[model samples]
Target: MSRLLTAAAVAVTLLFSQNALAEKVSVEELQTGLDHPWAVAFLPDNQGMLITERSGSLRYWRQGKGLSQPIIGVPKVWAERQGGLLDVVLAPDFTQSRRVWLTWTEVDNNGRAGAVVGYGTLSDDNARLTRVKTVLRQQPALSSGANLGSRIAFDGDGFVWITFGDNFHAETAQDLSALTGKIVRLNADGSVPQDNPFVNKTGARPEIWALGVRNPQGIALNPWTQEIWESEHGPRGGDEVNIPRKGKNYGWPLATWGLDYSGEKVPGSKGGEVAGTEQPAFWWKVSPAISGMAFYNSARFPQWKNSLFIGALKEKNLIHLSVNGDRVTEKERLLSDRGERIRDVRMGPDGYLYVLTDERNGKLLKVGLAE
Candidate 1:
């Protein structure tokens, strides 16, 4: 019996030691004094990056040159609670086209607000945006400032994808005609894709690719499979990671593992499962308030290859997820010592990880393997 106990202790000790080694990372502050930075997009050939701030400013940053003043010609945004400039991404053919896309909250004349996507050409000198035009806007806009999922991603086929939250109206998630709480697919020019699942369905918005999501804040294209992975916040608990498929329904208020903040069951949910709705690939029973996500496909950290890194807002940690095929397990939580609200995380072209902290004086951080 003593021999067995000794073996168990050794095994436990080895497990903990391995985890500690795996979590060792070096974080370096790249740029400081950003005002509530929301997202970051790398420029071609490492020329620079485009970053969006929640207060409606877009800044450029490059190594050694430091940060540039806000580029001119950015459209006026609502910039209200949980609103403002959100996501920025380069067009798939940006190198030749100099085209960029942006998403933000905009208000209508009646005080109703919704998320909108626009595109413009980044001037050769990177001084301002030119030839700017709005493309897509969410329908049935509401007054609520919560749950505006505005993440943008491009598929292998160069299709543009956008996520929309329910705007605090949970029931609208299941509504086919409403743009709220859904994923929409479109051509690079903002035209609806005819091959979309709902293009031929009556009373259904033709642009919708998937439905029934809460406040999805993270969306990324898997470097290996090219599949899009999304992460979203649940009401009180039930933060979820999902791979949204064409026309699939991800159970939101209709069926969730989360409860209302008031400790009551979600109003319409029967439970965490429903007959027609798809289950999340992974879920958190206690909400992490997840945000941006990225897949580590670089050799900069060989041990971290193929791992998925997600930012945690409420928990203030970087959640490392070990992914195999479609199955994922929580490998560890990192950067808890920093105690900042992680707004966005992305793998950089230099084979390192870049993180954005949401704060009055936000920071851009570069993370690499500890030597």
Candidate 2:
């Protein structure tokens, strides 16, 4: 009787938990009126936020007064599907240096659109960007705008890490000579890091840090381990979370668990178990079109203190994954009722999770943990 009673009690608890999860969670809108807002980062001094729109403008978001006029000085962008001003992040020393980094897409020397990374100083008045200079540009730019992987993160050494997409060119993901479908590491000044794996190689791009990625969108550092983690989109299924190692390749078109949009096999893709390629730390059998991401290491939400949060574009939801060291222990979906594409997920200094929705009338929302 005791064992049976215990099993019944466990079933009741699980049922209640499921009910609670299905309950609608409320979200507070901090700001709105954005046009396909892509990414957001908080100002270190708490002055406001830096937001990027795919149409090639950056805006400042003040807490009380709302979004300031579009800050000028952004470079020209392609402004087409899957292109334009993509990710924006402040320099780690922004409080003092006032420097910011951005990644976007533009026409390259080959007269084709390609990914680029640049930096500029945010003026004191928060009106415009200055001293802007591009440091990285995709060589032999491709004509497609369908897959421009763009995200920024800083590792423990304060070096900048930037991601690039496959540009719908599957072959580029495996070509060491091309900058596409790879991550690059650089100094704060946008120079290549001396320790870069390809610096001494004969023909590989010296800035390339890791290779063989598809449409990576998120990159963040694990506060405890200092290892970099990333998330990416897949065509049909097989979204991924990866801990990209230096000089290694996380297989993309060459190896994937996903099929093409038409349910056909990717031209050159192998199964996820292919040899000579690194596997994802975590991956989904169904495509969520994962976008921005952040690691939670704050006191504000104790229950979720060490989890990973990711925004999903195709599924229009927020994802929380409980991680233990290198393994994902559990998964929870949040804010799915809204059915809006979550473009970005960021943890503010105050411990709140901020999100950007991708829509013509997009929103900046503050998500709170339920008690």
Candidate 3:
């Protein structure tokens, strides 16, 4: 009888321990009534913010003023199942140039669609875009509707890194000559950087930096290391967070730790032991559907200094990772009880973590350690 009681107690303790390890955090809503907010960028003066909706509109928000009417001048976009105005980033010289860069699904002739990046100058009221020009456009346009992974990051050296998915063509991920499934580097003016790895390679676009990615949705430059960190969705599991190095290949279709959604082996090599392909610094066996990422350098959350924050769409939480050099040693999940798909994460100018929820009527949330 005592032995039976002891065994039962042990089982209970194990269950409790598992629950404790995966504790769900309480989320306090900050603002509501957003319309599928996809991206958020701080204004030049740090006094306000510009947010992009998936339905092809930009909204402005000033402290205490709340969200303004959807700004005009946004280019027409094909807001299909997963495509729309995806990301918005300010130019490195936004104060002087007022130039903003955007990525969206552009509808072309014959009703075909492709992801495109463009730049435009903001009008005087900062409410409308003007002089828009395409900087980069996807090639060999896809026939199906899926996987338009697009994100933009600017390096301090005046270069832009744009990530593109394989457009549901897994084979394209292994092709170096293809721009899909690659991170491409370009000058601020949309020209291929002369120092890019493929500049001298025949039949390769000079902008190609690194290849073999599936869907890199989250991208940011680490302010301390200046290295670009990206998070991407996996087939069934194996969501990955990686620091992309120049010219290195990150195996996607060629290698993966995930299985297909149909419970079959993924169409790739099984593990990261393969040569010539970069391994992720960290990966989740149960995908979180990581969408946006930002490194915490704010004084408001001193306890979270130098950590990386990721918005998890599938898991509906904010994932915090501690980085030691290039290694991810610790991970914590926040706002798990909220049950809202977090689509975008950014550091506000006021030194707090700003999050955008993914829903028809989303909300702008501020995350800080409870005082």
Candidate 4:
């Protein structure tokens, strides 16, 4: 018995020790003093980056220079709990069009709030996002500010993909009439594309691409497959990564791997998969509060090539996933020692990974190979 116990103890110690050693990359603070920074997007032509703060300020950053002042021209945002300026991305044709896309919690009629998208030109001076216009807005805004899953990803087909939260309306996740809890697509000009699944369907939002989500905050396209991949927060656990499909339903409140905060099962949850709903490509037994994502497609990190990078708010670490086809072959937690709630992760043009830590005094960190 003593021999057996000694062997087991050694194995456990080795397991944790191995994990600690695996996080070998070094992190450098690139910029700081961002108030609850939400997301960051690289600008075209190597100009700089667009960083959005939850307080409705759009700041710019450039290497060797510093963080620029908050760019002007943004409208008011509902900057309460879990609501604010969310994701920001540049149009794929930004080099030619000079357009920047932004998503935020917009105050709507009756004091309700909802996820809304808009675009405007980044001024020549890099000081303003002018001519801003609303591109899309989820329907029937609600008074609740939680679960506003707002993230932006440009699909390979020249369509813009946006995730609308279940809006704390869990039941609406199963309702096609509601735009909340859905992945929606739209043209660059905010027009409904004719190819959308529900373009002419009755009682359905033409922009909806997929439905039945909780609060998806991380969104990215798989570079190898050009597939739309997303990450969402579960009820209390069961954070997930899914490939939102055309007109498909990703079972949410009706079928989940998580229980309610009250320690009770969510009504209609079938414990993960329901007969007619889609399953997550990956899910966590314990919620990591996944927020942002990026695919390591650069040669600068050979070991991380083609891997998916995720930011965790509750876990306070960067997750490294080795994705093979539809399955996540492995997952590694990185940078947990920094103890910052990661808000966003993006790949810089210079082959480095940039991260935004969510906080009143947020920071931008660059992750690269250790010297």
The candidate scoring highest on lDDT is: 1
CA lDDT for candidate 3: 0.80
Top model number, TM-score: 1
Per-candidate local distance difference test:
0.88, 0.83, 0.80, 0.84
TM-score list, all predictions: 0.94, 0.92, 0.91, 0.93
Stretches > 4 Å off in candidate 1: 1-21
Clashes of 3: 0
Model 1 lDDT tens row, 1-371: 11011211111111122265455577777777788899999998879798999999998888777778889999888888889999999999999999999999998888888899999999988889999999889898974678998999998999998999898899999999999999889999999988999999999999999999999999999888888889999999999999999999998888899999999998998899899999998999999999999999987778897699999999988898989999989888777777899999999998888999998888888887665
RMSD of each: 8.9, 8.9, 9.3, 8.5
lDDT, candidate 4, 1-371, per-residue tens: 11011211111011112254364676777676788999999877788788899988888877666777778888779898888898889999888888999999877667789988899998778898788999888887873789999999998888889999988889898888888899998887889989888889898888889999999989999988899899999988989999988888899987899989888998778777788899899998889999998888998878787699999999898888898878884457777777899999999998888999998878888787664
Candidate 3 regions off by >4 Å? 1-30, 268-270
lDDT per residue as tens, model 2, 160-207: 998888888878988889988888889988888899999999888999
Query: How many Å off is the CA of 364 in candidate 4?
Result: 0.3
lDDT of 1: 0.88
Misplaced by over 4 Å in model 2 are: 1-26, 109-111
Ranking by lDDT: 1, 4, 2, 3
**Candidate 3 vs candidate 4: which has greater lDDT?**
4
